[model samples]
Target chain A: MHFHKYEKIWLIFGSGSLIVFLMVLGFAAFWKGTHPQSHIETIDPQNIEAHEAFQAENLGLHEVEDGKYIVNIVASAFNYDLGKDENGDIVKTIRVPKGSSVLFQITTRDVVHGFQVAGTNVNMMVEPGHISRFETVLKNNGEFTIVCNEYCGIGHHLMFGTVEVY
Target chain B: MSTKQLTFSKQESTLYMVFMHVTFVSLLIGGLMGLLQTLVRSGKYTLPFNIDYYTILTVHGVILGLVLTTFFIIGFQFSLLGKTVGISKKQLRAAWLSFWVMLVGTVMAAITILIGEASVLFTFYAPLQAHPAFYFGLAFVIIGSWIAAITNFRQLYVWKKANKGQKSPLLAFMVTINMAMWVIASLGVATAVLIQFIPWSLGYAETINVLLTRTLFWYFGHPLVYFWLLPAYMAWYAIIPKIIGGKLFSDSLARLAFILLLMFSIPVGFHHQLTEPGIDPTWKFIQVVLTFMVIIPSLMTAFSIFATFEITGRRKGYRGVFGWFRKLPWKDVRFLAPFIGMLAFIPGGAGGIINASHQMNSLIHNTIWVTGHFHLTAATTVILTFFGIAYWLIPHLTGRTLTAKLNRLGILQTIIWTVGMTIMSTSMHIQGLLGGPRRSNFSEYAGGEQVATWINYQLAQAIGGSILFIGIILMVYIFIQLAFFAPRGHEEYPIAEEESDALPTPKVLENWYLWVGLTIALILFAYTIPVIDIIKHSPPGSVPFSWPIGRS
Candidate 1:
């Protein structure tokens, strides 16, 4: 019911810090549009192949609009791929033109996975049946490795894909 | 009532001793695994017996995080309840039952991990399922704890009925609330394990809703960290002040923190799932607010503890900007270890706020930064505080006095732990920011040019891990010396005086149902919609078994 003067001061101060923090976070997420895969996109995990964008030709890259590309990927078992990992299943090396607004729309075929572009802001948990889409523009010409940061299975360590921007 | 001594009964002492030994053994194994994990990641060596990185990571998390902390907290609480409430022999039986059940559960889970069937890490999200035995074993561990909670509750109920509205003994009140929070919060994981994983592992369920299961996991996961933390808080509240020759800054404040914990701990778990899909940003933001609310109590702890030190120091004639800190007992490992641990939490707790932020979570989620944040709070704060408690506890339980040499070694060990954690956690944060992911065998990325950039931090982690391993060995040495070789003397329970001006702590602090009801409501409101939505739209789980695990 009662408290120390110092304790009261600190509590108010700490709560202020918390409020300030949540305010900035709120601003970034809402105003600045730096949210996570919050407004999510979904898929039927049992039938990844049947998904429209996941069709063989559409797997690697599809133009959602003029000059904007969506890299549709199925992150599963290990590597981030266009559809699935199997014998001769190539880990997609996405070559994007510099300054392209690339939307990475990815989901897992089997287990929980993470799609993280090394040295970039594109990171989202790739869960089965739940598509995680994040849009970013590759401004510079460079190669960025897309690694699965989540532990899917034993092969999680070997799981990676590439984005070669030119 | 300023008596300097409080004693434990023979049975009470035995319970404490046995559990403390369990803590020691579990710590040794877990600590070794932690070091080796970093080494293997640094590409220096490989695990023997077909063992792999994930297996070691799983064991490292389980033994250290779950087994050691649970065993120690139960033991510590029993000793406290025994001294404070005078547990009947009947009550002691319930306590013993809890201990043995937990031990069996731990063994079962450990065997599963060793045999390579339960390499599912501590989070064990479904579809990447473990053996049925692993799920059952962990269930036992949780049930064992629930049984132990019953004992705590039983003691409190008996005490309260007799005392008739008198404020419960401070330690009992805090421990009871801590246990109550655990019991309430663990329901999420308990449900996931029982209704989902166990059946799935046994082939009863054809598939699981992965999002639904992960939702359930994070629901319990965040609160589980508090379960590790609150005992160390109990220690800080009651014991640390006395060791520093001070009194608790405020008993009511201490009571309020625990009460607030019961209110806010469980409802905010959604913050852990901020990056995962199938959870709405609105719900995530709401939980972020709740997560931030939890920070208030911790800040109270920081303020209360610092106030206690200042008052104590001023009384002893230390003054000026930081002279009071200088006057405090720096050489006393009992105070020193936990003090540094507390300091580490400031940055750790700050990092937690970032992780909870819907926007900022993007920067560090799934990276080793999250791993670093955990080590700072749970690993250092809780683990170091436990080390501090052991300095007195092992000797007290073993009927021996802590010798000067043991204290000296303990001081050295504590310093090593702080330095090692500093190197390890800081490097982990930098590397994670630099895009090094955790929980994988990075050796699989060995010498790839991009991976090559991570090499130095990886080397730092190995160095840090080796230093930490040395600290663990010294801690064991100190424990053995205190428990078996130190000379006999009486040990006193450290109970700091509630600052005398403080009114008797509000009796409402002792009210359990009101807080528990609110907590349940909060959890339901926070989790129900998201969980239902996940299950509604979720794809059926895939069968992961037919696939070879790694390098196939």
Candidate 2:
């Protein structure tokens, strides 16, 4: 019903701090295109292998418009295919050229898993029957490891993939 | 009836005794599991048994997060209620019943977890289901808590009926806000568990919409943290100032904060789902904004609390800038523990801002940074306050004076806890920035070389975590020593008086129904679209897959 003068001042100062925080987040999401990956692509897990785009050979680096490179991945119980080797073996490295907008389109065959590249702001929950996608410019040149931060099963900790930025 | 007419009876003390015993035991078990997992996770040692990592992690999280905090808060609130508005014989009976039911539920759940049929962690959403007993046991615990909350509400209702025009005492009012919030918050997880998770675990369903369950879980999850923190806030409001020889800065401000917490905490669970799909980004952004709005109350709390320190410090012949800060009783464990808890919360609140942002959430969403942030928030602030509470409460319950030796141990426990938590959380935060994932035992991340840099931090966390275990063991011993065999003396329940005010608060502040109604409505407004879309877009029924971890 009543306020101490200092209490009222504190309330105002606290509210002002909040406004500043929200404004920075708003600026980044709306203006600077720095929002978390929300909309990119989707694929049902049950039919992922049969889907033409995710078939072994079709999963590598590809130009999807002008500067965008898409890496389609089908993650299962404990592993994700970063790309294919020369003999068609599943390689652990997801190689993308530097300064390119690379989109990681990831989905799981069973259970929920997280596709998180630890060093960069590239993370999403790869779910069963739904795809999780994130597109980010591979600005820094380094080898970044991707780990399944979500607890899927017993081997959750051993689940790691790599992003090689050149 | 006024304050003196409602002194806490011995029956209520026994109830406090029962609840606090549960808290300490749970704290002990949880701390042990936590210690083991930290070491194993560091790649420094193998888990002694054939038992694996996530199982230990699940036990650690559930025991500490759910069991310890719940039992302690419920137990502590009984004393609060008894002190403010006397608990009837009937209410005491109900409280005991609630305690037994909760204990049974905890045992049932613990059995399932120990047998390794429920390795799904605390946020075990649908599709990754646990044993049927695990879900059922958890539901029982919720129901037991619901019974306790309902009994509490009844006490408040009866108090209101008798004293029609009087403002509810601050302690009673604070407890009710948390209880009401808990009751409403539990529903979301209850629905997920009852209609979906339990049935799925029992083979009653073939598929489930993971998005719906996740949405529901976080709906409960975020508020659950507030529920944990509110008791600490209560201590800060009612007791901390008294310990420092001052009164609450403003009672109305404290109530305003709790009211805002009840309203805003539920609707903003979607902030946790920012990294996941199926929720619209616009809805996420809206929820994120609400999440930021929630920050105001905590910041106000920071200012109000620090102001008390200043006022008290000024009284003690300390004057001018930062001199007041120097006047705080740093040697008294009762003051020191909670004060340090509040200090840790400053960063905790700041880290939450990053987690709740759409732009920044991506950077730390699944990283150990999130883990580090929460450890500082709930684990540090809430646990440390509870430890401080134990210092006085155990003595009160047991009718003993905490001797000089035990008090020295108490102070050492607080200092050890702070040092360990600082090292552990700081390393976790930096490693998170370097992309170390939380909840993972990453012995090899993309093979050996890439993870080489993380080993030192991992070892640092292990060392810190080990020290924390020593602190827990010491605190538990002190609690036991105080409770069972210490010399008898009259112990006081710490409660502060407020400076003279207009006697009763404005009737509008006492309008509890309106505040709770708005809370429920906001929850509906925020959740309606996303929940509806989750059901509409996804196919039905997700079958439970058994966990692969070994039995204890």
Candidate 3:
């Protein structure tokens, strides 16, 4: 076999690659060695029993400080409604005091239901035996809509819940 | 070995060249649009360009996902299939038709999206309606692809009938896997458009569920990526060996890899919908489990393919398990592309495994992390494979030797691209973990610095993206040179290189392991589908459930 002149070029490229790989490897090692992982916080969905529920009527808004609160949530295939309203209309409202922190623990009885609190910046993963925690501060007072981001079967578009902040 | 009998006809070679031209053109178009999106979003380009972000995103997705992958696979498959099944010019014409139909579909889709008609991700995330033309154009593209698949299947069946009882060629196996996945997977999207979206858009159906639409859409979406990936794997298996001057490590291992790709890639679509409403937690868990199962085959390929490189490297005068790396031809794009492309599986495989994990997926889902993950695999593993393939094919197609200068440029482009994308994607993954959403036009915090880390990562991504854009431009220039001025038939290929060896068959290939493996995989699939239906169809008042406060 004849000696190829481009052999030197190949060697240079290989060496350059090696140096780049070393730099990346060093950066990764340093990053992994320094950063701390965010720990998972928890909340429950059964503790909001017979509390004075401030109904936000619409897909109302809410603000809660960084803490945990159990939200009683019921899921049906067609629509989701909170227990009851002042005039006795079935309303979905979980009112937490302003400046208090909470994680609205939610779940469903039938098909999967989506618990999305719109406009309040607290969206989470809701599942059974898994309290989807939304950790945030109640910096302002307002209402937010808890629209389901998940499609719970055919009537998914109509699956709505409400939250009111007092 | 007669030189006269060994060469492909002019028409066959022209078809191959056309496919390469289309792929490279689509790559440049997609890459430029993607760069524009990155620049505008990163605030680097404040120019008064009226290019819509959604339009550019749509072009990028459709062009990359549909055009580049389709052209590369069809082009490569044509050549390989000739060796596998004795390809004819008539079949080549059918392949060309597929390309034209796809080209029209792409143009229509681009027009529809650019004019603010259809802003949906090519997945066409539903209840979020786009123009009727977008869906109609998409239909034409799918139909064309289906025709292409049928043509391929017909040829393979013909070959099988003629060569009764022989195992399919490894190239044939990879193409078959991709074709099978495409035919099976496209049904979901086709059904969505036919039964749900089409009627809804046409005013025939009053109301349609977005959840159901999404479920079906991702069903097609996830497997489509595999369709793109398998062709790349084909090159890795078949061509990389010859280029590296080594034999395939294990024929049976390669067959198993294809079988696993077909089996696991389809049922794991729910992983994409993990955060979406409707699917049960238990169901999501099952999807996650199956997604992880895909990793086994991927790792198997990685091991087997890398081992081939090691053996080749050793034969070329390197010592030690790692020493083989030193002997590799780093400046030969024909050699370097596949080599670097294969190593890309490191991040691609790791990211895929992370996405497949249930708890971990929640952290990265819909975040810039997801974007990073796909870029690692799609851009690096698959697209880079195409780059390598172009070099491998140029001599055969153009009948000319690719210039050494162009060869050097191709290698430089591949390296710059690999390094630039790695840094960009790695940073995106970090930002994603910090809750940076993917596909957002312009994300802003309420005040001072809530997502500072994410912001910094995006900034770094912008810098890396600029470097990547330059590399892309260099590639386009090299391809043009290869097409126009490269001397025809300058490097004569030995006719012996075209024939297969009747060597000692690997135990895996000699047996019907793939059939048995598939049968077992089907059983696992059966167990999961029922769970999916149960969770999906449960009555609203069926069972009382609540979120658990904490886990042990």
Q: Pick the candidate with the highest TM-score.
A: 2
Poorest lDDT segment (10 consecutive residues) of candidate 3 chain B = B543-552
- How much is the lDDT of residue A82 in candidate 3? 55
Which has the better lDDT: candidate 2, or candidate 3? Answer: 2
What lDDT is obtained when candidate 1 is compared to the true structure? Answer: 0.82
After superposition, the stretches of candidate 3 with alpha carbons farther than 4 Å from their true spots are A1-101, A105-166, B1-6, B46-49, B490-552
Share of real contacts kept by model 1? Answer: 0.67
Candidate 1 Cα errors over 4 Å, as ranges: A39-41, A64-66, A83-91, A139-141, B1-6, B444-449, B544-552
Lowest summed-lDDT stretch of 10 residues in model 1 chain A?
A: A83-92
Q: What does the lDDT read for residue B186 in candidate 2?
A: 95
Residue B13 miss distance in model 2 (angstroms): 1.5
TM-score of chain A of each: 0.82, 0.87, 0.49
Clashing pairs in 1: none
Could you give candidate 2's per-residue lDDT for residues B246-314 as a string of tens digits? 887777778888899889988999788888876677788889998987887887788889889998888
Docking class of 2: medium
Scored by lDDT, the top model is 2
